[model samples]
Target: MILIGRTPYATCQTAANVKALRTKLFTTDGYEPRVRPIDDQSLPIAITVDLYLLAINDLSEVSETLKTTAFLGLEWEDAFLRWTPASYNKTEYAFWPQVEMVGGSKGIIMDYYEANSGWDIIDSSWSVDTETGDSTINFSIRLRRKPLYFMLSVIFPIIALAILNLCAFLLPNECGERAGYAITVFLAFAVFLTIVSSSLPQNSESVSLVAIFLIIQTTCSTLITILVLALLRLGSFDEKDEKVAVPRVLTFLMRKLKWKSRSKCSKVETEKDGKMHDSQSSLPDASESKVSRIEMPTQLHENRLFKEASTVDEFSWKEVVVFLDVVLFVIFAIILTTSLLGCLVGAQRNAVN
Candidate 1:
């Protein structure tokens, strides 16, 4: 008897019987409790317990409804009694009946203890007849939850941050948007991680899901930052007279895709030279020698390759689309590969465990 809390018992034991019962109970009784070992992984922990709710009833034939007796005693594991709730009617209560554990033929039995320190009941009022048999309540116990908050706090943020990262694909490439967008999303993930860490307890464990998400997001942001800088340096190739050095990989691929295009300067020069040749050939006293000289210069500049190179100021829509499609596919490949690797690692570890 350790007193869990201050709640008095309303016992039904008679004076003489209660005194004798206590002497017999505390001196003779010895029973021990143990767990029911279960090997199945799917099954949750199961507990079977016999509980007694002590009550008093008058000798009169008419019986009343069940009433709460304040005194509660827990004879088994003290830890279980303190944690489990014993709810009845509309209100919840603790098991504080006026009883004690005594060894029986099969297992433990509840015995009537001393008279509760309370007012005596009327003659018509029933005091529960404890002299004949033990009055007990039985129940089966199990846990409902296993620290769900700890698990959810780790899982939800990771999923949320991963979805947020997908926003990068929708952002337009021009206007120097990709770098800023990556930085903003990265910072947002950092803020979410800060909130997640505040909720979780500090403990020794593998990296949590939220931490993994933040790290991945940061890595993506760094990669995007590098790509944005590279693209900025690539610039508008059409604007400069100097030959743009394409990437070795792209140059190899582009050699097969390159096509002729006419620039404005070459087209203007060609039209002017054509008019001069026509005027020269139309001259009434035109010498054949002078005609050949005039025709050679115009013919050289009028060729398809020379004129096409000078006139094209912009890339065709089809080429632009193809370039973008390839770049986006590469990005998608990286994300898919990383996700598959994570899944593979998780699965392998699970199998090993």
Candidate 2:
């Protein structure tokens, strides 16, 4: 036979068993629903709540919110709702009916929650007031945005842009787009920095190290754009022109490439020894001539020193500019990685705490 609606289902023999159980548990002659449900008024009801995270729904940087879906399980033993299997029927256990949310669940906390996503579930929490013999079970959960989202989108992209900014040095000098490329990359860095800064709270009480990293990279990019423009002129200076002497600072900067004085000293010693031997061969009997010969090599040494300086001091503006490019590129690259690692590690520790 087919049962229509809930009429016959509510009046069936099995339903009668449930109805009889309810009467025996909650009727006026057996127990009052108005009073506290537990027989032991002194003891508080203990409830256990568990949450299973299902999915991350959305994360809002501006609002600083994280939405998630999860499953909630609540378990407690209600003395009034208890029953015996043999009394109801021949079965393993006689289960009571479902429990509804009561007291509006006063203690639940929900900063970000999924409303209608099918897998969404509310968090669970329970509070018992022993003095008033009042208890409330409130389901609650809190979730944070995963670090992967920030690392992949904001942090890594800024680092990549900073690295790209350094690559302007690698571009051909003859290309007209070199200056334009550098300026364009700087502007992109500025825009990204703006986004990062704006996402943070506009207060001075706290500063983010990640934001500091971006600011440093942005400053580096700014200097790179300006330096590249300057190098466009400086790098193209004619190397053959002897009128423009390289700055002494640039000369000092390129000391690594300077000719070693050790080799020059060895050459000067060889020349002095050759001259002494020649003077001794020519005038072996005269002591006065020997003194004169020794003095003559002193003047020769001064002339040799002047000759070495003229050859060694041949510095062009073009060389200085290129040397600056290689050096700054390496330095800024180190700054980029070191600052990034330090800030990220600090952020990780803060998150863990």
Candidate 3:
């Protein structure tokens, strides 16, 4: 009703429309929510669903799971709720639902785990839009992971540790620290593997290339430890002992892969009173003193070789140990490098597939 002294503004139109929709839809004569909106009994309900991904919350390589946040928009027709615009005196008509669809996304959502981070949603909202007697919900949601983090923290560090394991062979065996050094490196690798396995899901059916790579590396480290001890023992043997001798195959390998330091001293001798004075040292014999001759091996070693009282003209056990150390280092380094690269490449291929 309009007051006699005041002008009336029309506000009853929207209120009337809402009241009509509620009564028509909610009354006993109206349709139920569970009932299909279609007129035909055999026909299927056509509902339009759209998901707009807003963010990615987390990623777990171990579990092979990804967590994300998005807008789950749903649109459908409610034939019973339709009304004529002229009857409501409005261009468009919409009714907002009073109570929310509480806990709708509980089982559907993947929760990210962090010690201090909460799994609770900050906020969420929805709005209704209609044009062709259809109800559309415009939903909105809010979302944070780096793919390279694993490569840097896990893969790169493993490569570095493998390289360090190979370097243990470079330490001199006589120093008495090589054994301890190799053992420590192996222990560190074992610890790293343990930590990595703990984070991964135990029920995983597929084996990771990275995991295989680490196992191979661990085996190599163990073998290296044994070899180091053997080499140390070989190095400590008495030079004069004829009982312990270098193997013939090792001698052959040394000649084949010899990084030679050629001897510069030439053979010289002096004759005194028709008696030949053999040169004991590399220098020419000034005094006519007779000395025992020394037989030299094919391989010559430099001052970097082991220091001994006797003139070590021939290839000694120490030289063999040094040669083997270099050979093993080269072999393992190549193996580790190749395997690491292959592991990463294979893993990437699997991911793509």
Candidate 4:
């Protein structure tokens, strides 16, 4: 018998059973049976019956190949005179030379083992009950999946979307579009994840590698969105504030990051007055020296010194945001590379197996 068609994989056994034909020897009471030539030079004999068989699949290693087994046998109505093997010496009946050959039909899944070799005739046996005189002949066949279709349809698309998600980091934070870009890519990943989940078998005992990869990518996309928002916040600050005190930790971080800051040049009135007094004294001008020596109030000098100190102690918010962007991009690149490599290795391993 030949397998003509196959259905998609399901959590349960839903594929149609293989078709087979069963033959038995029977005798007419007083006359020889008549035969007529139907095709070629072979004569057609009557009494052959068609049988449909259900194949039980083992999905324990469904991530790889799916193996299935089917049994076919003959049963007789009369329990008293049961059918026996043609030769008791032989263990089981053998198929005719013509029936042993198998063929495949078009539109069947490419990786189907049955399509290439037909069902492998793994084992056959004859069973007889001594007490009841019941007898039967049984044969079993095994089938394996190719997995090419699933790889192309589901796995590849998901990986592509994951790579595309990394592009969100390339967008500039000042444009206020980084978050939007990341969110859009994240949504695309989600849609593809849904498509993959819908196609996978629902009753699987463990999650498939492809599913795990998608979950990780979704998490990464979410993180990218959050990072973009954080960068946006860092880029925004009150520009009018002349002195923005920076934390010590942030200062240390900036030093470590090698960020450059604009030099604060504050000209104090006290320093200018002192310089003027020194220059006038050298010129030998008594009135000019006295005028320059009129010291400003101590309170004003102290306030000017405090304001200069505050301005010098502040850091630039824009510089901090720029540094954050570089750091986040590095982290994002690392994640993207790791994910891509992991998926490629998995695909290679599956193909090899």
Query: Which candidate number maximizes lDDT?
Result: 2
Query: Candidate 3 at 231: error in angstroms?
Result: 0.6
Per-candidate total of colliding backbone pairs:
23, 6, 0, 0
Error of 2 at 235 (Å): 2.2
lDDT of 3 by residue, 1-353 (tens): 00011122223455666677567657845668787877785988788999977677778999999898766667888676665556666525454542222224442333664432423344455544444233344555432123466778788888889989998888986878899999988998899989888765454578767678888998999999999989988886645664365576776676687644222121111122112312234345555223312322211232224222122333567777888899899999999988988987886785555
lDDT ranking of the models = 2, 3, 4, 1
What's the C-alpha lDDT at position 193 in model 4? 84
Q: Over the stretch 1-353, how does candidate 1's per-residue lDDT look in tens digits? A: 11122332424234454444434334444212353233453666544455544444323336745554345334332222221112221212322354633323433222553433332222121122223344432322222223356347655555555555555644555557766776776787677767776664445476544456456665765565565545544544424575454444553444456633233445677778877866776666554767777766766666656546443432333334346435654685578458646855874674455
RMSD of each candidate relative to the true structure: 20.9, 14.9, 14.3, 13.9
The residue ranges of model 4 lying beyond 4 angstroms of the native Cα positions read 1-160, 239-245, 263-287, 294-314
Ranking by TM-score: 4, 3, 2, 1
TM-score of 2: 0.47
- The predicted structure with the larger TM-score, 1 or 3, is 3
Comparing 1 with 3 on lDDT, the higher-scoring candidate is 3
Runs of candidate 1 with Cα error greater than 4 angstroms are 1-170, 200-205, 236-243, 255-293, 301-325, 340-353
Candidate with the greatest TM-score versus the true structure: 4
Q: Would you estimate the TM-scores of all the predictions?
A: 0.39, 0.47, 0.48, 0.50
